[model samples]
Target: MIEHATHQKIALITGANKGIGRAAAEQLAALGMTVLIGARDPRRGEEAAAALRAAGGNAHQVTLDVTDQATARAAAQQIDERFGHLDVLINNAGITGSGQVSPEDAHDQVPSSVNLDMVRAVFETNVFGVIAVTNAMLPLLRRSPAPRIVNVSSAAGSLTIASDPDGPLTGLPTSAAYTPSKTALNALTVQYANELRKNGFLVNAADPGYVDTEINNHSGYLTVAQGAAALVRLATLGADGPTGGFFSEDGPVPW
Candidate 1:
């Protein structure tokens, strides 16, 4: 087996100021990889990095706002200068546009009544942002001997589960905006993985299983650490690990 850090693998995790992203950063840092906590908020990013360092993890802050092309380029350039190569890229930053926009609103805020502008807003960050950040960082990632990219997706994005009236996801009706954005992300993951595989890069989508975080108002049963388990696992896969796959903690998730 290849030593986890012999090649000094460096990982960049977006929206890592808190929640599952933060947890993944800690786990990766514990394994000897230098973990970059990519945050839109610099202060929060620094605080998270400080907390991780205090906990004995090799962590640092990277000011990353996936929606902004300039920030994405700067971050990629910064990583290239410091680490020379990026071994893992975790697109963990995401938002539930409706929830963030109107907390008091009911689940009916989505579906037929979902504001199209809100849906577009979420897509800007969730879909287009991922593409921008990934493309900007692809150069450094390509330099890695075994590069890995993990898109933090959700079970809500599964068209199979979403369309299945008998499935568990049928309970959630408010999916027009946040959910479809993730569906697009899943599609993007497959295409990127197919294109990057010949270059020894493994790109896959990870379903964290609805962990309790600010996004869900702490109603989820799983903790952030538990939610991050699947992401961390997929992020650390070896050269021979599966690619172009969408997985959860239990195993593969349907498209």
Candidate 2:
């Protein structure tokens, strides 16, 4: 494991303007890594970097919308030009579907009854969006000595837990979007990790157990900082760290 970013380990965290992404960026920057705050809102992104810098962290801002291919491409280009390479990428941007709709209650999500537009919007940010950014920035990531990709995911994406006959997630059994996107993200993690392993890049998905954030409408019990612990761990993993795996605060999570 060689996590000493003293060699200029530059990290980009999407959706870092706030919440768990913000927390991860803060911690990483505090560790002396050059943290790139990626956000759709430039004002918010700059503000976040300013706050981290005030706290003695080296931070910068980048205008990035993971779902927008143009923004993703340009961001990679800028990083390549300015930094010469990237050491880490955290795909932490995501969105949830409307109120929980159990699979059995599919009646509510009837192609006509529920909002199909909402479903598409959630997937755009949570699933496809992550893939878009990762692919776009891979050229920069490939240039690093120890590249790490951490997908900020959720336990809601665990099909084994969500589908078990008796499970804690049974409480959250429902979805028009969000969960499926994360499940898809978990799958994408494996595919990318498998491909990049030979390239010395580590890719893995992390479940930030029900963190209290704007994403969950602030209803969750864990703080954003607590949720970011697992993500930060994966982001800064040493060269020998695990890849193509799913993890949480407790430990490895079942697929």
Candidate 3:
């Protein structure tokens, strides 16, 4: 355990080596919080953290593979030993089982053809992983006066949007794997928020707005910063901020 001042807020973001996660980390660090770049690869995590430091931010690297319980526990332990408490936890690590989120790829993800193993793998990272990391970090988060947990979800997870005949989501293919995992994540976000609300822990889901990340094969229209905006906002929410809700930069998103 390393000794540090208790006044400083500490944040840990998973899958932060690149894309929206990295962007969110940089933005949060700019706000004066110590940001931990949690990545599955130690080298990449350290590289990202180094880049943040070079840019004048209080940043560090933590090797964290969200799907692995041991790594999640180790990350929590590291934070506990060094920061003593966690002010923010952003569950940004996720995957689209389909290689590319293209219209062609969408056809392969339809219920009948989608591989059950692929769906399980997607849920392992997006859903179960969130549970593992959040549970491991809860004790540290509870130490904060105003703890925040932001789960990075997607508009594709919204049942309202998916069910609408004239909605934007209606054009997309039915995704049995990626989409459902995010929907489950949204449910988890609400459950956690409801349970932790009395304790002043704000848990919410963030829709990153179809960013041009590797997950989408850089085909998305939004920029990384644009996608990260809602995430940073949720992570830095005040005590009076809404919890157990889904939101995007435009405002509240449907459940």
**Candidates 1 and 3: which is better by lDDT?**
3
Per-residue CA lDDT of model 2 for 162-254, tens digit only, reads 788688876553765667778888999999999999999989999989889987679899988899899999988898899999999799999
For model 3, how does the per-residue alpha-carbon lDDT over 1-23 read when each residue is reduced to its tens digit?
55456568899999999999999
**What Cα-based lDDT does every candidate model obtain?**
0.90, 0.86, 0.92
Candidate 1 segments exceeding 4 Å error: 1-6, 99-109
lDDT of 2 at 194: 97
In the range 1-255, model 1's lDDT, one tens digit per residue, is 332335788899999999999999989988888899999999999999999999998888999999899999999988877777888999999988855456554344467777666777789999999999999999989888889999999999999998898898866665788889999999999999999889998999999997999898899999999999999999999777999999999999999
True lDDT of residue 106, candidate 3: 42
Clashes of 1: 0
TM-scores of all predicted structures: 0.94, 0.91, 0.95
Ranking by TM-score: 3, 1, 2
Model 2: residues with Cα > 4 Å off, grouped in runs: 1-6, 99-113
On a 0 to 100 scale, what is the lDDT of residue 173 in model 2?
38
- Model 3 has an lDDT value of 0.92
